[model samples]
Target chain A: MADRSASITSQFTGAGLGRSSLIFWALVGGLALLGGLLGDSYVRHIFILVFIWCIVIASWDLILGYAGIFNYAQLVFFAFGAYGSAMLSIYAGLTPLLAIGAAALVGAGIGVLVAVPSLRLKGEYVALFTFAVHLALPPLIQQGRAIGMGGNTGLLGIPWLNLFGFQVSSIDKLTWYWVSLAFGAVCVYLIYFVILRGRMGLAFIAMRDAETFAQAIGVNEYKYKLLAFVVSAVFTAVAGGIYAHYTSVVTPKVLGTEFFLMAMVMLAIGGMGRFPGAIAGVFTVVIGNELLRSFDDYRLLLLGVAVVVTVIFFPEGVAGAFKPKPPEKAE
Target chain B: MSLENVTIQFGPFRALTDLSFQIERGEILGVAGPNGAGKSTLMNVCTGGLHASRGRVLFNGKDVTGFKRHSRCGLGIAQTFQIPTLLSSVTVGENLLAGQMFGSEARGSAPDIPIQDILYLTQLEDTLNLPASQADLLTRKRIMLGAALATGPEIIFMDEPLGGLNAEEIVEFLQVIRHVREELGITIVMVEHKTRALAEIADRILIINFGEFVMLDRPEVVLNDDHVVEIYLGKKHDA
Candidate 1:
């Protein structure tokens, strides 16, 4: 029986069964099974938050990590989704579902605006432009209309998201958690399989290595860069919409510098540019934040220090530490 | 193909002023000039990397003035950089794959010409899986050539293909370039400072001085021209 079990394990982990592939599928199956069995509210809440953050970080990774655009304005898109949906729902008396669509559109629109100028700039220029957006957006939203956004107070009592008569708020916490998980999984797969596997992926990689060279080779750098930014914004918007409904609150604080810092910390601690790195980063930073809650003021300081140390020493991050070594070639 | 009245201005400096030249199909045109003589600027304009302030780049009887680089690549124009602009992290095969993806008519439909064939052509068969960063300068030059070849271009533009190579490596690369033109029947436009080496390979040499065409004729004539020797070549034969 031991030998049989060993053989089974070997079959799964052996050549042609790429370790990452096996691990990914195993994690998927295990998560599904475990999510079904563990119906606890606390566990469900934690996982839901994880899934929401996973979407944001993963999408963020798509731009910053893969496309090599270090955008610090990611949370602005998230806030746009949350606030856009909230405003549309509150002011227009629109359905929550319609508001979600509005959020996505708003996110995409902002993505285009940001990407158009920012894509041409790289390194510090990209960071500076994105940072300006992050700083400027909330005030613009606040000053625009007191009725729509509620100004400083922010829109309150935003209705729960409902889809085709299936009320998301009425659903069980476990079911909602599973829904979030599924959404996150689909986002990951779409980014990894659809975008990264095709010719677009090659173009993106080319852009990352050398933008001028990519252009010399005939790639339309601006078009593809905008595409990446827009897609990333869409995913981030979806995550924000989900988070808004889950919490029943949409505030300026949602798009605050705190969330931006948290995301940077998470990405840095997890790994920059790796797909699984985003998820791992989200979990580590979020869980670490929660666990260090007792320290209060010192918790943030510790987190900052940890991020710096991780970046300096292990630039590859936690996921880097665990990445499987490539198989040795035959002599 | 021809560049008619092309003028490129970079801020206060005019890189190329009223430069006009024609390169026929199935011809190797060698561009030789001083460091700032605008040889590269001309190539950049031709490849659509730089938009000239004024002029029309006519390729196969079509005005490609506003065409993007990739569109020009699709129209059968390709260029290699002076500095090897390879994706350093990826293998040589992957670099060639990128070239094939962008420039090849295959459009990612059928199986690519095998990696082994590309490697064998550049004598990089053993280095297929090796990252470009791992390769030596000569190997990198060959890989760059291999990548340009993989594009399936009708015309290949090379910038100093023999820059860092030793005598043996230069001979090897010369043979490869000849094979590409002879066996594959591809035209070449080369921006080279190595006049002697280029003269041996190029069918015609176009000499530029101070961003203007000084002389454009047969390699033998241009190289032995008294004016070229006095100004650019610096009285080498006279000395």
Candidate 2:
């Protein structure tokens, strides 16, 4: 009890310049230095992917882990952001950066639309409904060619991200890497501070752990659930927007089954619902995905083995393993 | 607070049948019933966790039968579960803070009762930072009560607040409940199996069986009622 108390207290109060936070900032700085020093575009590119996916995973964690909502449509929101931003840039004549922000608003709207009906459902049903959305999205996007979605071939030649009059190009991978890093950092902090550390965080956790109790104590479940979806959707779409501009392409592949499965694996290994775990999960999976390029056909098999081993060793994911198991059901 | 002909039906099954009762202001109303007698159901209906299939719930003479649970909470209805349900992920302090922050009319305003007062009343002053999931049953129960009180509720519905405690723990817990009423002046409707504890703390006792009202009166009178006895043990005067 004492140990668990210490950990929770630290989680609540550790926003200051504590040791762990200092170490975290140092690591971020170290990675930035590495990006600057390494002339290898490949390594720098992997770091960029890591940064982008970190936002995705962290946003996913807010709803799935913190709110304990079984929302399977996170990737769909990402796809929406990708497509929405791309269309806004290509057809609507908006800058990539401004398009990303507008796309997030659209994502928030979609989040509200989805959460109002879906979040009222029981757990497994919510998962099924959202998963159905995930399955339905690609075909819908393909059929959306009349609206300049580019259909099967997807949207290409999307403008490069222009920052303050300077075009950030693919050739200057380092600039793209730093831009993504800064973007990811800002998004993660928004999630961490606005939801996880604010009053809503407590409300979300209460709603997750004990719905009836939370409601009876005046924590409006639907309100908080909707808030969770909107916040999650906003950042996830931003990540997707970044992904679109970073790659200069928007494709149906973003909504692929493999991408969803990879996300689940990252959440599993890094510990779903654990703060900072999602970030770790993103790094481990993205870097591991890049590292195992040589394995070819056997790569997925090895990744499966890694998941099994991680589950066996760290039942709570890598982050949870470091913390003590909560005392036997408070009976 | 009052319920008029509240009936809850789960498809073909009726959990509560035309249950009507009035809870006076500033009184501990002890509710007793056999297992599955709809005691908890009655609590649920009053607290807006469940909407009665038929009938009305009037809080302060306002028709709140259709209000959601949190809305009712904002109207000063708070509750503790039979099993001390808490946000296991957060600390005890956080749990109470959740109540004080959102449970009252305070919403974003100042809470009426300070969290420190609730901590001291619940005898959980020392373990404020402790994770609620790791606390013992006694502490959990106290935290549950504290969380309920933190809402600054006008009326609190407690389901089996003292269900699993030993004699000493029960004695200590009963004192807190008394403090809740005497010191805080909050109305309480407690569903408890322990009649003795209820008799000690409650101003009036209401008994039910098989979703039907059995008796409602002072502790001595209701406890001695033949129907209450039959529901508790067996037939009072068996053939």
User: Which candidate's lDDT is highest?
Assistant: 2
- Give Cα distance to truth, residue B183, candidate 1, Å: 1.9
In candidate 2, the residue pairs with backbone N, CA or C atoms under 3 Å apart (3 or more residues apart, or in different chains) clash, namely A65-A273
Q: Could you give candidate 1's per-residue lDDT for residues B134-223 as a string of tens digits?
A: 677877877777776666667888888888788988888888888778756788999998888999999999999889989899999998
User: Which DockQ values do the candidates obtain, in the order shown?
Assistant: 0.28, 0.50
Q: Whole-model Cα lDDT per candidate?
A: 0.78, 0.86
lDDT of 2 at B142: 87
TM-score of each: 0.88, 0.94
Distance (Å) between predicted and true CA of A94, model 1?
5.2
Off by over 4 Å in 2: A1-24, A324-331, B104-108, B236-239
Q: Residue by residue across A29-89, what tens digits does model 2's lDDT show?
A: 8878888998999899889988999898999999999999999999998998999898899
Tens-place lDDT per residue, model 1, A1-331, is: 1121111111111323356456766786677777888867777777788888988998888888888887888998898888878778777877877787788889899899889889678678999989898999789878956557767777678887676777777246876777778777777767765666556666777788867667655566777889888988988887887777777787788777688788888899999776677778998998788889899999999998889988988789987878666556444
Worst window of 10 by summed lDDT in candidate 1 chain B: B105-114
